[model samples]
Every structure is written in structure tokens, then in C-alpha cells.
Target chain A: MNPSMAITEAPGLFTANGLTGLIFLVMMAVTLIGGLIACTAERLVRSVAGLIVCFIGVAALYYFLNSPFVALMQILIYVGAVCITIAFAIMLAAPEENKKNGPAGPLSGPLAFITAGIVTIGLIVMAMRAKFTSLPKVNGGSVKEIGIQFLTSYSMVFELISIVLLIAIIGALVIARAGRSK
Target chain B: MSFLTLYNNLNTFLYLAAILFGMGVYGIVTHRTLIGMLISSELILAAASINFMAFNRFTAPDPTVGQVFTLFIMAIAAAEAAIGLSIIIAVYRNYKSVDTEDLVELNG
Candidate 1:
């Protein structure tokens, strides 16, 4: 008898597998709901809040994918830094109450929906038709391995990204401060 | 391959990423304000990250590569947001409004 056959069957509710699945479903729901609010909310501040919820769900998804370090980083960066930055921008610039943020043209709504629908359906179909053969993992991809790779294999890239971030920060400050009055 | 174990499947993640990407596209097309567009762009970036992490988990031989790539993506996204918001702020200062329709000097 083959040992892997048992995993093919569905686990009952209350079991560990079922509980994990339930949690996964909850995370998915949370992500989708947050995305919906982010896209559809009337107020820009509300959209930022929804984006926070969405990023948290995404971090949880990263956890389920076995990258807890990346998950934590997601929370630390996206929610902590990025969302706060966006919120500040919204406060500084967004005039949500006065101007209506509706679709530009009459056909824009239906056309956008169709375009997005086609894109999503096309990607899903492509993924379904394509056969993916998984290769054996060479390493566990743990935090330590990631650290070593950053130092050894991908050192140039890591250095480049830091430089990129530094330039972005300086550039942003220059651009935003251009029109400011003393 | 039961529904309960969908989390272990690659297609599930693929589908989720696809849907997220579609929503981002829709948001980009529909949202009229610059800040709204920036928010939607974040969704697109998140979708791309999910795709990377999924392939990394289910297919890649060296899983750390995807995580590293995702980290880079995060860095890029942060930089993008910073630059983009500053640009938005500048536009607002010049035009006194963030609405796309208002900034129509180059429209031919």
C-alpha cells in the first residue's frame, strides 16, 4: 500500500488539516474584502485603511507559504512604513470630498471591467494549461540561507537596491520641496 | 487534491494572484485621483509578489531566490510609492487639485 494515498482524501472539520484550511479561507476572505474596500471606498483615508488590512492578509499568506521572515518584513515595511507614507500623502494632497472620483468617460467603466476580466481569465487559463514540474529544493531557504545569499551571491543586487532607495528618498524630498514657500 | 487542501496547490495561488492583478487593473482605469491610482498600483505590486512567492514555494529549486526577489520588490515598491506620492504632491501644488481630468495641458 502507498503511504501518500491518505492525503488525497478530504479531512473532516475540527481536524488539524481542516482547521488550517479554514484559516486559509479566512485569510483569503480578509484579503479580498480589504482589496474591495481599497478599490471602492469613497474616501482616500478609508482606502489606505483597507490597504493596511490587505497587506496584513498578504503577510499572513506569506506565513502560510513558509516564509515567516518575509511575512514579518511585509508587515514591517508595507503596513508600518508604506501605509503610513500613503496616509500622509492622502492627508497632504487628496481632495476627495469636493471632486467626484468617478470613471472619466461613460464607456470607461464597462471597458475597464472587460479588459480586467479578459486579463484575469487569460492568465488563469494559461496557468491551467501549462504543466509545472517542481524540482527538488536544494536548500531550505531559511533566514540564515537568505542572509548568506545576500552577502555572497546577491551582494551586488543588495547594494544596488540600497542605492536605489537612497536615491528615491533624496529625489522625493527634492521634488516635494520644490514648490514649498519659506 | 481536495478543496480543503487547496492551499497546498499551485493553481490556487495562481488564480488568486490573477484575480488581484485584474482588480488592480480595474482600479487603475477607474480611479480618477492620483492617490487612488497609487493605491491601486500597490495592489498590482502585491499580486506580482504573490506570483513570485508561489512559484518559489511550489516550483523553484532554490526557494531563497524568490524570497530575495520579493524583498527586492518590496524595496522597489516602497521607493515607487515615495517618488510617486511626492510627484502627486507637486502636481497638487501646481494645479491645486489631484484629479486627473484637471491636469490636461498635454491633451491633444
Candidate 2:
């Protein structure tokens, strides 16, 4: 079912279709490089920056998956909220200056690499080989549909999440405020 | 089968998520600081969401279900980050350090 031209002939460099493909390729590169930087960088600040880049790429991937709502939420939640919160923690906690040189772990260097590689390879192989029965979509997972689902099916979870967020906020303030000198 | 058309394939996103999860595991294992570990844990969560989303896009009977699940994941992750960072702050205030090595009061 694959087109011969799709493989043998490259899509035109100037066309819109080609541009989307190009953008996807770029997003993939950004995600990979950002993840590598996030994992490997010695400094905490740079790692946070890399995390932002990685999240942006993931957002783009969500866009490709056809859920613009989730994609926007990915950017808003991950890049705007989470990354900024982490940056604030880095500033307040000051991981860089306080970073002590020590043995990372007995499994830090190569053993961790091998284990991660194995996990990655196993998952990829499983994903590639598995056959999914494509069930017909009940409703288009649009933003409107999502809103309805929140109000209808997922209302309980929705309320629970709000309570969780409230608790998390109050708990955070209380914990961080404790023992702070006036 | 074209490289440019990877966006159409379910396996592409799956492989991507797997790699991201692997990176997360590696980061958690190797990072010496609590904040760094938290950052890695976020990566793992992101990977899981991507998997849910990919299935939602491709084969799910109720597409809204996966999206809703992913949304819940984001909320949980946010809350987790908040609580975790606060704990790290408390730990830092007490110990004056965030390194796991220095945090070994239980080491026998």
C-alpha cells in the first residue's frame, strides 16, 4: 500500500507537505538533542533549559498527532508552568554551587547506559511487532469533546484533580515556609 | 515507508516515547541532585503521556479517554513537581546541600 514515489522520490523542498515533514524531522531532532542535554549536562540550569526544549518538541509531536488542545496544554503546562517552577527551585535551592563532587554511583556510567539502552530497544521492538486492532473512534477527541467529557464522564476525576492541586499548593507553601528566618 | 512520513506511523511515536523513557531512567539513575531526579521523573511522565496520546490518535475506541487520561497525567505531574520541589527546598534548608551523597544519614 506504500507509494513508490514516497520512497524513491523525495518530496519537493518548497511545498507545504514537504515543509510539514521537514518540521516533524526538526522536532524529532530537537527532542533527541534536548533529552540528551537534559540527561547529560552537569549543571542544573542548563538541564532545565534542555527540558524546556524537549517539552517544546513533545508539544510539536502532539500537534502532529492531531490534538492541538493537548499540544497547547503540553506547552502551557510543561514549558510555562513546570519548567518555570523548576527554574525557581534551582534558583532558591541553588544546586550548582552546592553541587558536591562524589562518585555518582556504582551503576552510574556505563551500566546505566546499558540498562537504558536495553529498555529502549525492548520497547521499540515490542512496539514495532505488536498488532493493534483499530477500534472505531466513538467521538472525535476535539477540544469541545474534551470539555464535554470533563463535564460528563470524567467529572469526578476533574474535581479530584482540582482538590489535589489545591492541596499541593497549600502543602508547598507550608513546607517551603517552614524554618525560613524572618 | 518513506522517512518523511514517519509522522503517519504509530511505531514512530512509540519508538520516540521509548527512547524518552530510557533517557528518563538513565537520568534518574545517574543524577546526583534531587531536582535533577525530579526533572528526569517528569521526562518519564511525558513519555507515558505520549504513549497514551499515540494510542488515542491511532486505535482507541474512545479517543477522548486517552486524552482525558493524558490531561490527568499532566495534573498529577504538576502536583508532583510542586510537592517534590517543596520537599527538596526543605531538605536543602536542613542539610545545606542537595547532593544524594551528602544525604546519606541512613548509610550504615
Candidate 3:
């Protein structure tokens, strides 16, 4: 019944399960490292790369959370679409030659870091202290169930989102195109 | 609390989300460029989604709700990104710069 023992008894250090776990760990590392780079890198392009890495990590995390559908969507949307779009923006708008000067005010950079650190610590402490009672599962959150819930319970919101997306697309095209003539 | 069961703990995900949120805040506050700020905003939204999914996995009665909600959030985020980037492009064309410091034409 002990799967860990069975896993360890396999010849190589990388059994199927162990290899999966290792890959997960590596992905986690990539995610965190990417986030750090995205937040701290001086260059915008490097930050975009970090964002891609972090997103891939998030997708992996989604898979670990038992939502492969969302995970794939995350990769497709965030990495495939968003990051590439951002890269194009970086190229078009952001000047590559300008070195990042320190923040505007004298205390801006340090103050921002301190503020972020404090907020992170406070939230982590609160989360750790809170009492969370586990609830019984009504139904397994399968892909079929997700589809049914999307249509039934969240149909209004789903429809609204489609409309919002449509508006966004038209608005983006309008705004971006408005400048080309001038 | 145990190291071996880190993935099973709700708090781990919460702390991760918290970190992501804080990083997003820092980026938003400090980034000079509009596009960078938008990217940071996306990070904040992703952090919120993580928190939702964590609660969904650990405590929600109907877990599909959270997943669906997260999906909606993703959709909104995608649209937001598209719009935001286009706005950035438009602004760059008008002002010739994306730096927040230089966007002072409305100072009057």
C-alpha cells in the first residue's frame, strides 16, 4: 500500500513518479526565479522573458491543482498570446537603449521594496494563523462538471465576459488605429 | 506544517499568492513605463486567481465554481492586456514616451 516505498525500490533515481515530482520541483523553481526576474530585472525584455517563465510555472501549478484544462489554457493564453504581444509592445514603444535610472524620488525604490515586503509578510502571517476548515466535496471538479457549471451557474458572467472581450478587441483596434492616420 | 506535505497545505498557496501580490504591487508602484505597470497588474490578477483556486481546492463545497471564476478572470485579464497595450501604443504615438514622469501635459 505504501507507494513511496515502491517508488524508492525502482532502480533509477528517476522513476516515473519521482521524475514527475522532480519536474514539478524544477518548474516551481523556474516559476519563482522568473517572478523574481520579472520584478527585478533592469531591462524590459528580460522581464518579459521572466514573465513567460513565471507563467509556465503557473500553468504547471494549475496542473498540480487538478485542472489540466485551465493549465493548458494558461499556457496557450498567457505564454503563447500575451507574452508575444507584450514583446511586440516592448519593441515598438520602450526604448532599448535607455538604462533604468533609479526610481524618481530619493526614497522611491527603497520605500517601494519595504512596502511590498511588509505587505507580503503581513499576508503570509495572517494566512498561516487563520483557521481553515475543510469542506466536503459536493462533486469532483471534473472538466464535464466545469462545463456544466459554466453554462448553468455562471452563464451570465460567461456571457458578460464574451461581450467584454468583444468590446476590448474593438476598442483596442480603434485606439491603435486612430494614431496611424495622424 | 510538515515539509513533506507542503503541497497539501492551504497556507503554502496563500503565502505564494501573497508573495506574488506584493511583487505586483512593487512593480506597479515603481515601474516608469505604462506597459510594465500593465504587466504588473496582470501579476496581481494572477495572484488573486491563485488564492481563489487554493480556497476552491481546500474549502469550497462546489470546486468548479472557483475554477470557472478563475477562467473568467483569465478572460478578463486577456482582454485587459489587449486593451492596455493598445492604449500604451496610442500614448506612445502621441507623447513619444511611455515614462510616467514625462506624462505631465495635464499639469494645468
Candidate 1 lDDT over residue span B1-108, tens digit each:
566777788888888888888888988999889999999999999999999999899889999999999999999999999999999999999999999989999999
Off by over 4 Å in 3: A1-24, A99-102
Error of 1 at A10 (Å): 1.2
lDDT comparing candidate 1 with the true structure: 0.89
lDDT of 1 at A155: 100
The prediction achieving the highest lDDT against the true structure is 1
- What's the lDDT of the predicted structure labeled candidate 3? 0.81
> Would candidate 2 be rated incorrect, acceptable, medium or high by CAPRI criteria?
medium
lDDT of 3 by residue, B1-108 (tens): 223334555776787889988988888888878877887887888788888888888788887988998888889888999999999999999988888988999989
DockQ of 3: 0.50
**DockQ class, candidate 3:** medium
How many angstroms is residue A88 displaced in model 3 relative to the true structure, after the best TM-score fit? 1.1
Over the stretch A1-182, how does candidate 2's per-residue lDDT look in tens digits?
21111234556757766787789999999998899888888888988999999999999999988799999999999999999999999999875554732229665678879989999999988987788767767887889999999999889989999999999999999999999897
Clashing pairs in 2: none
Ranking by DockQ: 1, 2, 3
